[model samples]
Target: MASSTYKRYHVHGYDPRQHLEHYASDKPDMAFEEDVLKFPMENLAKTFSLGHIRGDVLIDFSASCMIHHLYAACEFFNHIIVLKVSERCIMELKKWLDMRTGAFNWGHTLKLHREIQGIGDELPDKEEKMRSAIPHVMICDLEKENMTDPIVLPPADCIISVWLLDNVCKDQDDYIRYLRKCSRLLKPGGHLILLGGLGMTYYTVGKDRFHVFTYDEAFARKALAGEGFVIDDCKVKKRTAMCDLVDYKASIFIVAHKEK
Candidate 1:
């Protein structure tokens, strides 16, 4: 109900290891690799390769300590800025970026990305690329007027947010308002890439449960349109795995452009 509640869960209870092991594990049944990771990677690669999306600076709004979704974008953009809501999340990400002792190994995710791109033979160093591309990881509050306040980041060429809005917003209206706030971080005609869980109410991490705002594809389309974004592409994947750990019905990915 309150924003503090959401922050408490993530800042205190969120475990990067548990989050990665549960969702992005090498397990076959986990739809996260195919539905969440691979789909977005391929879409970004293809878009960037075909010259559909062009940008020098790319900003990720939901960095969440996961670099799998960012592998493709690094090839096209020179500068990448990752924004997180919780300090714990920022620390987890820095652990990896700094190559600390307990950093979560993302080799499996990088391997999958290389396979999808058909670059297994001549794979670029993904970890190094990610570390070099992402120079800043700062705190951001979606409800605020300037997400990266005081710092005053330049408007990004593209913004990416995955599974962030539903977890943070209290309802659909709140979600839409947050979406508009995120859009302000982008330049006019800049792209917005979003990945979210459809029809999900809550998810479990370790022993604690967190809330999610549920909505369908229809609602997503209308919300993006209302926020002055033109939907360039949208994809939805039905859930095949039935796990009590997470109760999402489907995964939705959208690529939208802010209207000039």
Candidate 2:
């Protein structure tokens, strides 16, 4: 994979609305969205519903402005904190929190989440529940000395980071380094639930292809174990359909607890 050809996620300014429509919108022809977004929501609903990994606070460390996965999360956690690298993402998130006009509708994703849990259709009041649980959306730098910058956040009971680190890290070493950084945010024995594409090189968004840090299941396990996390559960979703816009062999979801 030529790293030069792919754009860095932090360097490019993404249209948060465009991105949501591309992957999370309810379109019949969105094959890539069907695989990439829905798979994670299914895993999260199943995993969190097991009643083992949840707490008072959960932090979101995912790429793009997607919060559909967190719909299941708000049910378990008391407060949700969103950490984003882009100002555009922060603003878009706030729009949802405030319930402004034109905010990307997460209704379809919520429907999928409810479906995965075998619950009845229609989440009442849509995302008002999730929005109520989220108290803050702050700017974070994955590479900064303090990822949250200047403000050091209180250690969280759990952190749900999906599809963020893979795009932020340039290589395997960087991946491990970022894992350690994410681990620092959790209290001792706090869980870190992560999701990412496996063996993926790049995914296109509106003519621009963004880089994906390629790694396999074994490497991910080793990295987490090396960073003081003990694996509690792991789930993999093999690629369901073939597509050129998105490339990946599988998607990995892990639930691991930090061991001091």
Candidate 3:
């Protein structure tokens, strides 16, 4: 999309309502499921299929409510890192993890094989080993320079950021820069997955306003390519259909892998 046209289409100074609270309490009705389902299962099975995740680390940035599902989906990974900037998110995941520790949250069915380690402090070897047996969750603010600051994370095999790019980038260039940083976090031949909130016009939380850009598949591909990510494969999924029945656009789901 042309920059001029893109700006014109987006409602200036739009703020999204804080839906995270609603999501934290209960899954608010949005098109996120539709978007996730839109991913071509065949391609996903090939790319993200458990067998492909050989890296020792899988970093999930701004993991929000996905910790539960991701834990179930990625069984092959030895270590799964869950990153989130929200305390509520951390609290919820911690609660879930805590329950699993004692007698297994929902019986022996909840397999606690992966560890969920928080960022910042150095964890003890024994603690790390135990946590690695369950999904690890950490509280981190990626937008802040001190913690995430782009230089803190280890070289990862796969870095996934969902519904977070639009919030960080002020414009297309900023978005591209964010993508470059994401690429840097991954090792050569690693992968990047971008998910959530694609076609939103504006979002508001409390008094905050979030400006959004409706990024299409081609636009996402171009942005990733500019960041040196060759499209190994891509599947577009709709995130939300908020407008009245007449006019609505699905959020775009993009999965782009970094190349050598």
Candidate 4:
């Protein structure tokens, strides 16, 4: 979706699938954040319990193709729902899931779609599965759809949106609004895991190059606090570029949880 609003403001600099050693930029030959350190999935599981999932409902916003977190959540939760505002992201996820149809359970993998409310209709059947076959993954985005739309969801037990809000938002105000939207999707005492380049300048995905809004950790913490979320625990780390091109400043990753 090309927008006149975004003239040369491309968000991604390289394709997520490509090797950073191949880039021509002057950035130190690090590695894509996704490929660098295996996201602390085990730690995430320890921090939040799917078994204690408040309302049998877990929602994710702007969950791009990164399904690792989702896969981890399904280990305990029953009904996992994902919403995606970007059709391209949705299609890409579907394609990835399709590849695993043989060993992976598509029906159990998730109910990925354009909206989060769709799960309400399938909650019954979803809860029936017992042996870790939970709806652990759902992706929702605010770009293609409005957060107020009935299709959007209320608060959920676990809410996560990584590398989403900063890239799509128009400015700081827009970013805050998007975070509030994320809060709205969770129940009062749910956990919201937010991760991305805190001021992630420019980077490559695989072959596509894009620019990040340079979101600030301090500002993000304040925004989350303003949204009634308690900074339960937050860890900030510098993200080094993997591409062989120009290495920009380091990026940050933050995690916040909604207060009861």
Candidate 5:
């Protein structure tokens, strides 16, 4: 029998609405936010507060049409450039940024971020800050040497990538190659904050199942070190919730700096 073609997937095959319903809900289960979102945001906040990561231009390589992970970075960077792999993703993000009807509600995410940073009273101001910081949302092709070709972006002080590498890369070598490509967009010694799911091979969206590269903490460290990054913080939160939609064993968060 011929192999199933349903396994074949593309970035555009991803359903933004289903993704939001699954992961960006206002009151996601405890494990969803606590393990997946809070830990990463807290680590980012701690890094910035200690003066380890700062930059005028912050480039978001994994613009997955969600801003939940952006609140922390917005507090530190004045300019945020979001690069998406697919036009569908870009359109989803634009809806939110432009305040179009039926945009995914991120109020819960904003509230959680404020609580994490102890800036509950400054939510409005911070929201405005993020709005002003994110002025550009463009397309990128990770397979290309210049991810954002024909449009040379200024070297960023820091780059944030969340749940991007695993899905795009077919194997470990591709993962490392893409990492190098993204690293090139940052200034020397610039910080790289990575958020990823561990031991994840596939995640379901609506009726489609997409591939995710399987990896672990040790492999992640090795990859970063090989890419000339100095690992500053590595945190792993074991998976505590099980949903039929996604199969991930743990959540890995890393903060590293490119060392030339």
Candidate 6:
């Protein structure tokens, strides 16, 4: 586990609504609009568009309660099992999944994704589709010997992690160690789509600032290669929306498949 002195998000303390308000808001100038929002969604759309990422089960290991990134992948996989580290994030995701009152409005995110897909008219229907694609959202810890301990998850065809490693890994070594854990969940030759920040050291939600593991593009490629994943595609977008809320200068999206 990460040894940072700051309030780590790996625990049960993450405030999902606060994080949503800070990063997932559709406000015109939200600081993380590019890094935390569009990068993953856009890249996901492109990756799935290539017609190579289809499978029976797609496991999502992401940060926060945000659901934007999964909109594009719903059609490619039969079922999506979201693994969350914190109960708070799981509860927040449930609130949205169950369509309860005051669930964070993911409509804007869906709209953004559809716009990227050129299927701008798909709103409420597509929203429901994404919800149906995801049938399970359970708690799991990457630090655990069996990330999905009690429930033995079938080896996934694909795994997508968005910014979760930034919060869970304390350093470069922790990054590789946790990555091996993630790989173990995959079927051999399965895909791994990772989205992370470049040179990002911290992100603030509400009044608390959480630590982020700082790494560059080279380190990312090296780590994935070292862990037996062959890099298929890697894309980097320089931080366009600048703010003090986060320290990342750029964001990265990589599509890799585990070697059989």
Encode model 4's per-residue lDDT on 5-43: one tens digit a residue. 331222322222232224212234434433222343433
Strongest candidate by lDDT: 6
- Root-mean-square deviation of every model: 2.8, 1.6, 9.1, 9.3, 2.3, 2.2
- Candidate with maximal TM-score: 6
**Tens digit of per-residue lDDT, candidate 5, span 160-182:** 99888877877889889988887
The regions of model 1 sitting more than 4 angstroms off are 1-13, 27-31
lDDT of 2 by residue, 1-260 (tens): 46688888887867877777777788786676556677777777788889877788898988888888887788888999999999999899888889899887777777677778777765676488888899889998877878997998888989988889888889999999999889989999999999988998988788888888999999999999999999999988888866677788898899999997
Show the lowest summed lDDT stretch of 10 residues, model 4. Answer: 108-117
Whole-model lDDT values for every prediction? 0.81, 0.85, 0.51, 0.52, 0.80, 0.87
lDDT of model number 2: 0.85
Against the hidden reference, what TM-scores do the models get? 0.92, 0.94, 0.64, 0.66, 0.93, 0.95
Model with the higher TM-score, candidate 3 or 5: 5
- The superposed Cα distance between candidate 4 and the true structure at residue 202, in angstroms, equals 2.2
Models sorted by TM-score, best on top: 6, 2, 5, 1, 4, 3
For model 1, residues 1-260, the per-residue Cα lDDT tens digits are 34235333343548867777777777676656766677677776776677767678898877356788888888888899998888888888888999999888888888877887888857657789889999899988665688777789988899889888877877788889889988888899999998888988777677767778889999999999999999988988888666787688888889999999
lDDT of 6 at 196: 87
Q: How displaced is residue 192 in candidate 5, in Å?
A: 0.8
Clash-forming residue pairs, model 1: none
Residue 222 of model 2 has an lDDT of: 98
Candidate 4 regions with alpha-carbon error over 4 angstroms? 1-30, 33-37, 40-42, 49-55, 100-154, 205-208, 244-253
Clash count per candidate: 0, 0, 18, 48, 0, 0
lDDT (tens digit, per residue) of candidate 6 on 1-260: 23255677886366899889888898776777767777888889989999988999999999888889988899889999999888988999999899999899877777788788997684668878888999899988666799888789999999999999988888989999989998999999999999989988888887777888999999999999999999999999999876887778888999999999
